[model samples]
Target: MSATLGCFFLSMWLMRRRETVYGWFAVMSVAWWICGYNQVATSPWPFRSTDGWEIANTVSLLVYSASFTVFILRFCDGR
Candidate 1:
């Protein structure tokens, strides 16, 4: 976990990404990775679980989904 966290922070620093919507895409991916890690750690047992981790993971995925959809539409359509 420490190594993962260290790599994440190091990558962020090395990236130095701008504050554009594209940057938000990277953020979304990172957020999803972290939240998904949490889900894996918790094992997501039982359908009765209603933790915030699930919500976060869902939201992060949604950001990526929407962004990728937009990218496909604009880039593919040449518009």
Candidate 2:
């Protein structure tokens, strides 16, 4: 939790620098944070025996994957 907050602050500071890579990295960090939260919230057995966790996990993974891919491409292409 503290780590996430630290990353958030770092991202904010980086944003002020007006760098494209930092912006993309911030976005990726946000996606990662969301995915981590979802996992923790649904871990150690769900409150209800449903597919909600599976669905949320899938969606989070997709978002994380897409953001990371974009970040890598943008960084590599010097966006």
* Cα-based lDDT for every prediction: 0.55, 0.64
Model 1, span 27-74: residue lDDT tens: 445555655666457555443466755776687678757755654554
lDDT of candidate 2 vs native? Answer: 0.64
RMSD for all candidates, in order, please.
6.3, 4.2
> What TM-score would candidate 2 get against the native?
0.55
- Clashing pairs counted in every model: 0, 0
For model 2, how does the per-residue alpha-carbon lDDT over 3-72 read when each residue is reduced to its tens digit?
4654775677576776455655666676667667764563535535447766766776787687678769
TM-score of each: 0.41, 0.55
Sum up the clashes in candidate 1.
0
Worst 10 residues of 2 by lDDT: 41-50
